[model samples]
Target: MMAAHGAPWFAGWGTLALVNAGLAQGKNRSGLGWFLLSLLLGPLATLLLVLLPKVRDRMF
Candidate 1:
């Protein structure tokens, strides 16, 4: 088990990455790209993703 002091830090970042991935996908962006970016940029990436435009569905 991780140290008590380190548990929250790891869990918080992990969860943030997951949510970021989903947000990216929702925006029609690359989920994997956002997930990796979030691991480093954290909240900054989230803000950017939120400001990005959603992909429009092309129904031909």
Candidate 2:
């Protein structure tokens, strides 16, 4: 039934995922991993990303 609305419903989530991916990369984390996680966990993944500790002593 929800499918009737199509991807539009989740379009916001997709945008959020892209933004989260960039945030993950900035934090020296895996952008792809966060992108995948956002697909399943949605906004919750974003919250987790926000709360996760940043990598110290970055190689680059």
Candidate 3:
């Protein structure tokens, strides 16, 4: 249902962040950064994922 509706903001974004954070770590660290960001950030993570870059570029 959510997959069909393009509501993958939760899974996909978390996965992407997790992978990126893991790659950023290079093999020593676990996915703590990923889990922390995804957990603490919550829906704000989604908002930040979508908006942070643009906000940084002053696209707002």
Candidate 4:
């Protein structure tokens, strides 16, 4: 059925979202925000994360 064919795709997308979340966290970004964004943007989110610079903490 159509559902069977789409299940793997959905699973992969979900996995990618998790990976993006971790990647975001590694860059000192919000994991949950990236996770939600990834759920909507998928690979595009990964590309954005890759292109983004890491956040540095300021010692004010």
> Which candidate's lDDT is highest?
4
Q: Could you tell which candidate, 1 or 3, scores higher by lDDT?
A: 1
Off by over 4 Å in 3: 1-6, 27-30, 38-60
C-alpha RMSD for every candidate:
2.5, 3.4, 10.9, 2.2
Q: Candidate 2 on 1-60: residue-level lDDT in tens?
A: 456576786898899999999999989899999999998888999999999999876576
Error of 4 at 21 (Å): 0.3
Error of 3 at 21 (Å): 2.9
Model 4 stretches astray by more than 4 angstroms = 1-3, 58-60
Candidate 3 lDDT at 15 equals: 75
Query: Which ten contiguous residues of candidate 1 have the minimum total lDDT?
Result: 1-10
lDDT of 3 by residue, 7-51 (tens): 576677667666545543443333566457766665565454544
For lDDT, candidate 2 versus 4, the one ahead is: 4
The RMSD (Cα, Å) of candidate 1 is 2.5
Which residue pairs clash in candidate 3?
none
Each candidate's lDDT (Cα)? 0.92, 0.90, 0.53, 0.97
lDDT of 1 by residue, 1-60 (tens): 656998899899989999999999988788999999999999999999988889887798
lDDT of 4 by residue, 1-60 (tens): 345888899999999999999999999999999999999999999999999999997688
How accurate locally is residue 11 in candidate 1, as Cα lDDT from 0 to 100?
A: 91
TM-score, per-candidate, Cα-based: 0.82, 0.80, 0.34, 0.88
